[model samples]
Target chain A: MIQRLLLLLFLIVFAVSETADAAVKTIVLDGSTTVGPVAKSFAIYFTKKYGVRVTVSESGSGNGAKSLINSSCTIATMSRAMKEAEIAAARKKGVNPVAHVIAFDGLAMVIHPANPVRSLSISQIRSIYQGTIRNWKEVGGANARIVVIQRESNSGTQESFKELVTGKRMRITGNSETQSSNGAVKNRVSTTLSSIGFLSLGFVDSSVKVIAVNGVVPNEKTVKNGAYKVTRPLYLYTNGQPSGLVKQFIDLPNTPEGKGMITELGLVSR
Target chain B: MNIGTRKILDRSFTAVGIGSIVVMALALMIVVVPIVYNGIGAVFFTGTVEHRKMLHAEFKRGDSQNLDSEVASTDRYRAKVYDMLTGFEAELETMAPEKKTEYTAKYAQVQSALRALLGPLPGDPEPMLTRFKYGQTRWEKAEEKLHDLLYESKWDNSNSSVMSKEFFVSRAISFEGTSLARLFPYVKENLENMLHPEFTFYWGFITDSSVDSHFFGGIWPEIQGTFFLAIGAMLFAFPLGVVAAVYFTEYAKPGFLNSMLRSANSTLAGVPSIVFGMFGLAFFINTMKVSESKSVIAGALTLAIMILPTIIRAAEEAILAVPKTYREASLSLGSSKWNTIATVILPAALPGILTGGVISLGRAAGETAPIIFTAAVSVGSAIGLADVFSSPTPALSWNIYNLASEHEAAAQLRHVQYGMVLALVTIVLLLNLSAIVLRARISKKLKC
Candidate 1:
């Protein structure tokens, strides 16, 4: 009986191993919390269509670059372009950094649904971030302290905001609260009445009011036409040219099904 | 059994007991030593002049005269480094366009590294973020920045079978023939003079509010929030737990109903902490509309329910542990049964009950999951006492998870995370220690 049981266990192990070997094609993408939702949706779609597994990790863009240079991931999804130093580092490791534009995203300035302010000029936003304008009343809103919320320092969204809205030389006030993700910023703004925060356009929902930037509200058309001021392109970086599952996954943005998925996720399709 | 076999069994039993204790001690040390060491770094470290300057500028606590003198001395050494950068910029202007572009990018890296190490360079625009307004605040971080200034870190991935290895190339080598070559060595050598390092006891790490997403400043908000949540849980749970215990021990007779209630209590205790959080969300926040959203009162009630079983169990055991003679003595002295239970029985079991209460307090404070959907937030200042009814706040247990896992700059703020863990562990351990002491005192007083 013991010998028959041993034989049965061996057969089961061999079958499992054979199936695992057959299922070797997998894609790994990591980085950029801003682009995480799109990456996740593509992974789900690709997996469902092609029966290939795809894994995505939402660290910031810097870590994604690091993962690519380290050759740990097949693709690195970033909301921002790779920095020169990061590119050089990847080249040094014999990894040629290539960019694939997946979608366009606008940085939506979000406030509580109860907030009365509809539009804020670029200069007014800068002044509020710079701590010069402390109260909502100072910017045509309610009489409450403007509780500024920002993304953490290493966030790709944070970097883009620094480049576009707040000048690189300007500092966000020390008093402003910092959240980690676009989702977190949305949550904070939606719940807190006297708060203002920024999130990726994909995360914009009815729970929070999206402030018009410089008299233009960010939508798919405005962001795509470059009329929205705080817009950035999302990217998936592959080490050299992607082939097989990686190519198929990255090419999803250009396909009708892929565009539908991207649009469904509230991102501007390429 | 033979005498010899019996002796061997006894010896083996003793060995097993000693071995287990040694293993436990080793395990505790492995976990605690790193926490204590890194936690100490949060408050006590070789702080640079920039640290003093930050304190002076932000909190207005440091001696201005002393700080001014140190800044002046550091600036004297920093002047040469700035001069080298200026020289390199001029040299870049004279080079060919391609050379200028290459050098400019490389030069930008060097300048940012220097800025990170020693704050703003001369002729640089004033920085907007409070982070860039000061240089490396700690000496160890200064060394790390100095290394960055000297070398460009790159990965080597030659073999497909193995992981890539990281190696640093000297930045001086890259700027071999350029004027920028002089900048690396000069900055590397004069770093100490440029950032006067001195040991600092920054007690404010426990008291002051954080700045710039905890890249600077302290964790007082998280600590205070943990206190509020734990205490609030106790305020609701302790009385209810003891009342149920009294009912079970003194009034209720053992039967099917009693057994069913006990089984339900145990079943509630067996439920997962995340389930408790979900229940809190559904029953309190969603269904009952507890302050519209996540609030301290909602969290406290959730935690109260979560810990209620443990508290009831502990109170029952303590009440049972009280000598029956005490009750008899009270009754003989003409006191009614209720009076005996109120004054005599309760006072006798007070320490044991307190011991359980203290443990539950620590458990509530250390818990993260139950409060995640109830009261805890990733980033919020300490709320006023009145705000506990309606507002959410950052608690130590939840923020530790947030800072470690979810913070964008999680890698850069290891000290803060360790400090938080240490703070929580200390709070729980201190509560337990006080309970142990109280029990000892109670035992001694009873003996007398």
Candidate 2:
């Protein structure tokens, strides 16, 4: 009985590996959670139109870079451009990393809607995050201890926020609570009376009031016109220039359908 | 000390024991009741016409004819809304540029809120996202969207002594002179006609693959992935664990090596789950080349290792608990030692061994950390059995975290998250229940 069971297990494993070897036209995308929705929407539309299977994984921007370098995924959807070290690593692995700007996202500084402070200069925002300004009064709000919220380090949104608002070398205060995603940060800022956080502009809604940075609100026009200093371009990276199905997918953002999905999800069309 | 004092102490000890049990039960109720309540809402809720329309369009599970009629009825009421919007736009076109700019911003907010409530406005190009393809599917959400349409939520920071308070200002009041002012009251009165909410039981929440990051459809992929991972872990871990237990209990001598092995087992049990996740990624994927990257086989192997110490410990205890008399009698009757151990000792320990297996199975199914680096993907379809070695699939535990904390629409998809939790709990409970029943039957047979 034991021998038969062992034989059966081996057979099953062998059969599965055999079937997996069968070539199917599939495009695999791995990367930033911020870019996941856009990638997924494009995959759905792409599959329907071209009859090819598309799968996406949201591991993180750093891991997406790793996947692309390892040649595990066809496209790496990143909210931030690849770092120098990552590009060097890809080159060492005989992979030529090329980036395609798919869409633009603005990081809106958000607070509880009731907070009287309507805007903050980039310097004031930097001071608040750096733990120098611990109270709302320092930023012209009521006398309450300000609760700082930030995203986990792995998040592409967090990286972009760091580069845009806080200096790259500066550290966020330890007192800040780390949320895992944009939705979580928005949820925290909306519910907490004296909390502040940044979110992708698409996630800004009625629940959280977005405070202007440098006296300019993050909107489609401001982001497009370069008035919104906090905006960053979302990207899809491939090894060298993409070809065939991957090329079609990389070109999705320029298509009307892709642009519509981007706007629908509350991102700026590039 | 007297006899009376002894009796009093005994009574207090009993009371303390019962009190602790009561507290534990209460704690379990506090955690489980809310999950059950909101989880039920995922299936049984007041669904609107849009819900039926979505079901027809996405899954082809509803009556198209009935859905068409529902659409026609809702559209009749919706036409007035469209007309009012057109009238307001026409009214804006003829106004001064300054006035147009003022109304345009506020008017834009109203238009978007209305779109959120009733879906894309008539004559707009079709929305590509499944979430935008339909309006509010649940009547409760519809009412919330309607409130957003009617009122602008504002914060009252008048009291400097406290945090700001939220207050609503009527959008109609803001638009008093415009045709859009009439749209608010009209929508308020005709909401029931526009939505046509009916009590619906959505069994498909369990059976259908999610559409567009769970904005619509079901959680079939997550449920199947969890089953595959848990059962695969058990299949790999059970036999090895049982054999190791037999060696420790029946054959191993009490020596330095045996004690060291025992300590190693305990140490393995105490390792944090996340450490196991990191090890799995490094050892299985990096060193062993397990399917090139994260896959179900790698995840199962990691979980099997995580649960192995527990299974071995439990099986050892179960073997030790079997009475010595049966083995002695079999040996005295001229049966070989191996025969006596297999027929007499093993049969007697099977029930207790199964109890341990069941508990470990539940742990394997519910654990999130070990699989994060090995097997779980945040989003994927139900992969075939053949693809388990190569594909990473969505499991209930990981997706629950993703949907609750990471999904872009986390706030809006609370029901999906709750439903996923309930499904996972049910799956684990059913597994334990079957094992319990099997153990009971086996014990009864042994007694006879």
Candidate 3:
């Protein structure tokens, strides 16, 4: 009888504590490897200002949508807008995903900083990714083979590149090496003399030459004004109309302070 | 020194030894407990009805009749939750536009939380992704989802001196007097009926292919790849290592050439693993154009080089450890020097040589760096024996690093990562265990 009473007491305490755990505020932001850097910075600043514990995960845009639809995350930070299928899926689950544009990013074609080739036409770039243009000399560079570095299949940046540059129905060569993230792609391109890869404009550094496409170099001005072809808007998706902390977080990129932070990270803010 | 002083010193020394052993054991426990606990979760946990549904739909492994009955029972309770949602939606439509918008936002939160806890509602359209087709497969996640339904979490930033604290407001209080208010309590009360979680032992985790980058599935490809790479390395290194060891022990005179060769072996052993990857890439792939790109053959070759020196050293020691009387006896019985060395000396050293080979195989299997450039790929289906010369495959070592670090949903798949680690540890330990048993049996036979 005493053991039973003690067990009941222990269970009561456990139940009470478990319910109390719900009181802690946490904002979960997931999705988009390309938008990861900006989301991380925003989370840090937001947590500092609002005292909200913000968790950010960089799984890719599709996963971000999945998280939002699944109600796992409060905000899904995506480098690309939700596809029709994703929006339908969210609506089906009663999650009215509302897109908030945060920043603009350009897919910059990068090569070894020492490579002499200045620019490539859209068709030439397509051919290179398509495996038709295998050597650097074909694109007016050295005699080395162009080691194509690409992001893995889960990357939103890779999806965007395929849509804008590679086009559907054309496959990237099997020999093209696959890396997991923008940083990895940049690392490969920087280290390999004959390698060519694409990264978000913000990830471009002096170690790699951010080559021009169709006579236009990717930058804040070029990407923002639509002069650069391979540009996309970064987004943060919230289910229905965001309120409280979620609203404040979604509106961060519009604030003067947030714009400065975004620009510092090499992203173009409207 | 006095007798008591000497005794005190001796006691302290014994205490020190015991303390050190305790510390080592404690360290080992600290490292192993979490791994074993989480690793067990990969195969054994409170699996919900959705987990069963996923198994039935994806792998076709569960009983249809039992699953249907369970679904029917859960659905009987779930109907009321859906009724409350539609009623709330209707109430919102009749309200003022501003109020309607406000309620719509709040209503969506409750709906999503319900969807997460249970599967998609009756009126909801079919979901494309398998992840959405089911609710929380694990009971812990289900409870977390239920909390989201009960409370609306908000951050309290009133204090400026410290980090903000989060506070949860009861959803029932937020929607007081509304049709949705009654839904929260009713659903919470009947959550067990909604999701029948049971302890499941899913042995398929070792055999099944992963679903959605290891959100669910097994580590079969990684296990097979480790086996292939390790065996392939042994195929190349064992005979060559043993021959080199034999030559060094019996034929080579102790002179300048021998010392230089020994120094070179040590130098090769000292090279960092990542440098071996780079060298493999440069020499094997780029220079020799081995199979055009990364392959099992290339990886095995790189691993053989990495482990060759160790094998050679071990074999040399084993050959030297053989008693001189055995070789002398064989020679006195009119046996040629070469025949005596092969039949008697090698037989005596066989177990020792095998122990080295087994250890080398484990090293080759666990190694990630040398294979990264030469053979390992982050993601690929398991290849057959014929494809080893041309195809790069997912290995346990590389996949563990890839899944733990680079996977988009790495944190969500902690169970898979731990399972992979446990699988690898088991494989390596088993190899070492077999080596021990083999050596023991050989020693027993020799004595007889």
Candidate 4:
């Protein structure tokens, strides 16, 4: 009986190895946690239709670009444009990295639902993240401690937020919680009454009230027209020029199905 | 197999042990190596000086071809034909529409003639010729440099550098209309955009903190948060676990209490860290009202509970290993059981207890699941040792998770993260190694 069981196990293992040896394609995406929902939705939607499994991981836009440089992933889901250094690295690896705009994202400044603050200027937001503004009353809210929340270093949303809100030079409050994803931050703020955080427009919901940046609420209309200051393009970076399955994946943003997926996932289609 | 062959075979088998060790080592390496390899470019960060010099070199060499006043630069040649671009770009911000078939004939004529005449310039030559073909501003900026020589009455063929009349026939300097000479200072300064320090490396995001300006200048608060959380966890878990282990092993009833103790320990270990976090959020953070869920106390308390089983097991073994002779002698000398425990047994078991504590510390240093569930705040105030109870602190592990998430910070911190990790591992190793050495010393001193 043991011999027969062993024989069966060997047969199964041999069969599995044979199939594994067959050319299987994997696409890895790492980037903005804010852009994660749309990327994940797209990956699942595309894979089911095309039968090509695509793995999606959100480290931040910079990490996405970094992944492209290291050849760890085929596609990098970025919330920002590539730097000259990243481009040079890709060229070194004989893959001229190209950016494909998958979608447009509007970064939304969020406060706990209890916050009565309606609007803030970029300078005011900068003050909050910079730890200079510690009281909610300073920003037209209750006399409460202003709990500042931030994304982890791998989040593209935070990258764009740094450029727009803080001029990339300010420091966040030291007592910041660094959540790994947009959902994590959003969820924390929703549960914690005194907290404030930011998320991609897709991750915005009723639990957290969206505040206006410079009196502009992030929306499809505002972001599309570039009226929203916290808006940035979502991108996919590949080593060299993308071709074959990779090309098809990159160009998905241009297709009707891809657009549908983006819309369904609550992100603005490029 | 002969004796000589057998000996070689034995040596070969032993060498394969390292291969297994390599596999194990590689397994550990993957968690760090892939990310390190991905972020290696960030380590080669050239200070602002190198970046500035390279840009300066490129800009100077860009115009090296036509030092002569008569040689029409592309920007000057394009400025002569600026009307075509200005009209075409009126429809869209991007020149995508201009790249269509309608502008091709004129585009072809203008491009071919310019490509042949100017040959090439510095920096991204292909984009202007292809992707950004209708981006007349880039050409206009280049052309504005040539605007001086473009439609001049002298029309001396020259390089794009401002005409000092040395490189041209217009030695008299007799231009009446607002000469492009007035704009030379502004244009020369504007050209520096090709090489200006990009603030992206510092700015974490649109809503960046002030630290972005200082190039990740300091993380004293986050460092403080990490230190106190681990210390607090050790403070809370170590004694509780050791006492529980001692009581269970030394004094508990065999039939019911032993079974119950075993079941309790296994169950405690089996419980997911998230459930503990939920419990902490509800009990300590919310009900007890010590601080917010993101406070360091919440994390420390939760992690203490999480690592209790590990501490208990290690302590139990250590306590059991204590020689019975010491306890017997203490009892025979009219000492109470509690007295013996406090004096003899506890002192002898101190090294084992320390080992258990350090092992728990190492686990706490790397644990994400419990912290993620507990007091981890996305952003918190600057916490310090004094603020350990009230403030939210980001630990080393969480910092890595955070660093890998923010693109701007990640771009700049790849090396810092590795260095930070190296530091964290070194500290943990030191703590564990010290415990090990102390264990050895105590064992020798006690002659156990």
Candidate 5:
């Protein structure tokens, strides 16, 4: 019985390895939850148009960098550019990470649609996140305690928000609740009257009211025209200059169909 | 300190025991009732004509002739809505510049709301995403979208002392003088005619792969992945765990080393599951190069390690529970030690060992943390058995988290998340129920 079990195990390993070798013309993407939707849509369209299989994994930007360094994925979709340390790590592994800007996403500060406070300066928003401005009244709103919502540490959107609104070195208050994704953050902000959270421009809907940042609203025209101050370029990193199916995938945003998908999802095409 | 006082205390203690059991039962009910209730909505709900259309187009299920007739009937009502929109647009083009500008923005809002309720407008390009290719599939969601179309929801914060309240302003009221005013009431009255909703039982929620980030389709990939991961872990851990248990119960002598090993087994059980996840990544994927990255083999190995201690403890207890008379009778009958253990003790202990195995199997299936770093992906189609070593697949436990908290349209896909939770719960319950039945059958056979 033991011998038969061992034989079965050996057969499985052999079969898996054989199939793995045959798995060409397939693109594997790993990265940001922010970029996951776009990647998934593109994968579906790409498979339909070209008959090449595409699979996406939303493990977060940090893991995306790691996956690229490890040569596990063909493309690493990210909402933030790779950090200096990540580039150095990739270099050490002989993987030259190249970034391709796919689309532009504006980080919109959203609150409950009922909130009296419609706008906040960058510093005021930073102060609220830092816990110095605890009550909404301090920021020209009602006397309720501010419910600050943040994305998880691994999220690229969180990193981008930190860089744009709060300084990278500044610590977010312990009172802030950390949600895992943009949808979760939107859900919280939409439900809680005193809550404030940030989401990608594409996720903004009437469920939550988008507040002005630096006196400019985040919308397609504003973000595209550079009037939106908190805009960031979404990226897809490859090990080197991409080739073949990877090249075509990285070039998707340049195509009309891909551009339409980006606009439909609420991101602006560069 | 009298007999009567002691008897009163004993009765109170028994009452407390019963009270605690009742509390536990109530707590279980509170947690399970909502899950089962909402989870049922995933499979059984009022489906609109759009839903049938989506199924016919995507899954290639349903009667095409019936669907075509339904579409044609719905289109007759929907055409009036489109005509009203065009009439309002033409009225705007002939108005004064400032009035046209004012009406244009409001008209744009009305148009988008209509697009959301129905599919894309006539002049709009074909939507690239599958979600936009069809209108609301579920009647409940379609009603919510209709509310969004008929009225603009605004928060009432005039009195600032309390929380803000949401109130709606009718779009028809705002567009009183315009042709669009008639559109809202017309659509509201004829909604039942426009989208013929019928009670639908979508067993396909269990068998079809999701489309466009679970905006549509089923969760077969997650279910298949969970089964693969759980069964794969059992295949690796069962033999090793049972052998370890037999050695601990029958062969290991009571010594300092044996005591330390026993302590280690209990310690392993107490460690946090997340620690196993981190270790799985560090040891299996990074150091051992298990299938190049996160794969089922690596995840199975990690889960096997996590459940090993429990299996060992349970199997050891089962081996020990075999009546001493059985072993003695075998020995007296001139059987060797190994022979007695193999033929008599193990056979007697099989049912109990399987009970523990079944419980561990449920745990392995339900665990999310260990697989997150090793095997689970947020989105992937059902993988074949041969791909287990190289590709990561979506498991129910992990995808449940992804769908509920991370998917782009999480609010809209609450039913999908609930359905996934129900599927996982049902699978684990069924596994346990089968174990109970198997145990009863084995014990009955032994009695005979």
Candidate 6:
């Protein structure tokens, strides 16, 4: 009887404390590293404005979609559209996920600043990466072996590159050097004299020269106007029409604050 | 020194050692604690549900807002929803308070219909306002309806299969189930999505099985390719390693030629693995026109050379460890020098030779840099394995490296890669342990 009374008192105190504190909302955002900065910025502003918490994680687009499918995150940020198979999988689970354009990104083909070549035609760029053109000399550059750098499979950047450059066809060169992230690819290209790699325009800077593909450089105008052919939409895919914190966070990325952040991050405004 | 002084010194030294272990353990905790603590803290953190509800309210706030699109669907949705809500409100004007329930239900249906219709608008603002006007009236009516149905709607809160089950259960959950019962928590997961995920293009190099255009399915062909290369290495190294060890330990005299051979063999062991790879490429692949400069045979031969020292050392130690008395006994029986050494010394050292072969095999399987220069790409399904005399093959270590470094997004599978490492380690461990166990069994049988 004494123990039971103590438990009752404790329960009462717990209920009182629970009622005293306001609830918090947590939204998990996961997907493309390309979309990560914008998502993170939105999450930060949303959290501050509404007192709701948001978590952001960056994997590649494929993994991000998996995170949504696997129920690991509230939203999947992708630089590509959801494939038919993914939509079917979600529908199978009775989840009719909705997508909203978060922003746009121009995939950048970059090289060391020291590289002599300033521009490459789409055909030339494809040939370099596809191993058909092994040496830079063929493309009006010094006679040096072009060290081709590539991204790992899970990267959204790789998907965009394949879609835009290869038209979803052609194999990558056998001897290509692989880097894990945009920074790593940039670093490798910067340090290696004859190395070339692709990155999202969001990651472009003075360290590496963003080469013009067929005289088209990666810019907000280029990407937005579709003049930069190697561009993909950054997307926020939700399990369903977001209801609750997720919806609020999703809306936040399309707001003035979110757009400004995307612009600052070098991502093209949607 | 007295015995007690010696004992005190030993005790203090032991205490120092124990203290150092504790200090190291504490340092390890410093590294691990924050990770574990944050994981626990995030899981147990509360106050999420109310925030979730509030966010939902935000979505509905502008639900009655205008959509900018002039599309046919938006126009139809806007007009249909406005008509239903306007008709409901007009109907409500004539309704008595006793008939408020019917008016409310009709009002809710109008809002749901409006929300459903305008949801697809691409942020167009004109039709959205009309949709919103209908939604607000619908929202109030729906809230009332929700309050009435709240208890009945989520009555079966314990159904694990329902994602909304958590919404109905009391927030303060205390019971912890055994491992078997823990399966209920994951019931809502779309496991098929995990089992059949849409992979991107990076997986194409490994396995192209996704039926999708992205990946090539699996690295199974690469794995098989690596196996072929490692097997080729073993084939060339095993017999040669054993023969050299047999000659050195069993038959070679303690003279100039023997010592010269021994010194040269020992010196060969000092050559770097990469040097061997280069040599193999130069001598075998390039000069011989053995398919290409980066073929499996060249890689295998290069690895065989790299592992030669290991094989030789193991075989030599095994053959040398065989007692001279056994050779003498066989000689006393008038057996030929070759026969006596073969029949007596070789049989006794079989276990040791196998131990050496296992070590050599492990090194061949795991070496990456050597194969990188000598064989095909670090991880390629296009294996040069068909013509054993010419083709190049990739290796497992190369597979891990390529998957980790070059395969976009394969870096995200750190756990899977780590698990693969664990598997590789287990293979080596089992092989070594099996050799030890075999030696022990053989010795026991010989003793009996």
Clashing pairs for predicted structure model 5, backbone only: none
Taken in order, the candidates have interface RMSDs of 27.4, 4.6, 22.8, 25.1, 4.7, 29.5
User: Which digits, one per residue and each the tens of the lDDT, describe model 1 over residues B1-448?
Assistant: 9999999999999999999999999999999999999998899999999999999987898889988998889888988888888888888889999988998898988988888898888777665345667999999999998998899866454442332345789999999998779888888777889888999999999987676547788888788778778878988999999999999999999999999999998898789999999898778876787654467898999999999999998999999999999998899999998999999888788878878987998899999999876787554444556566666667899878767655544556789899999999998998788778777887677678
How many residue pairs in model 1 have overlapping backbones? Answer: 2
Model 5 reproduces a share of the real contacts of 0.40
Residue range B191-287, candidate 2, lDDT tens digits: 9999999999999999778888889888987887887788789998998999999999989999999999999999999999989988887788767
Give each model's whole-structure lDDT: 0.81, 0.87, 0.80, 0.60, 0.88, 0.60
Give DockQ: model 4.
0.02
Using lDDT as the measure, what is the rank order of every candidate, best first?
5, 2, 1, 3, 4, 6
Docking class of 2: acceptable
Tens-place lDDT per residue, model 6, B1-448, is 9999999999999999999999999997985565345323312222112112222343322222222221233344344434434554665677688666654663454344334322322332322111121221112233333333221122222332221111233111211221212211221132221112121122222322111101112234344555566667878898899988888876778899988888888888887777787677566654665542256677788888888877888899988898899999999999999998789888888778877786677677777767755664432223322344433334456645544533333423333344334434544556466667666766665566
**Candidates 4 and 6, the one with greater lDDT:** 4
User: What DockQ results do all the predictions give, each relative to the true complex?
Assistant: 0.02, 0.40, 0.02, 0.02, 0.40, 0.02
Instruction: Note the B-chain TM-score for every model.
Output: 0.96, 0.97, 0.93, 0.59, 0.97, 0.55
Query: Which portions of model 5 miss their true places by more than 4 Å?
Result: A1-26, A50-53, B1-7, B157-164
Q: Model 6, range A11-74, lDDT digits (tens) per residue?
A: 6434433432232334656667677556655754565467553545455688668657655457
Once fitted onto the true fold, the runs of candidate 3 whose alpha carbons sit more than 4 angstroms away are A1-270, B1-6, B123-125, B159-162
TM-score of chain A of each: 0.91, 0.89, 0.89, 0.88, 0.90, 0.88
lDDT of 4 by residue, A43-138 (tens): 655555676645454546776676566554577778878878778877786657777888988888887655557689988888888888898777
After TM-score superposition, the amount by which residue A20's alpha carbon in candidate 2 deviates from its true location, in angstroms, is 14
lDDT of 5 at A216: 92
For lDDT, the strongest prediction is 5
Tell me the docking grade of candidate 1. Answer: incorrect
Q: Candidate 2 vs candidate 6: which has greater lDDT?
A: 2
lDDT of 3: 0.80
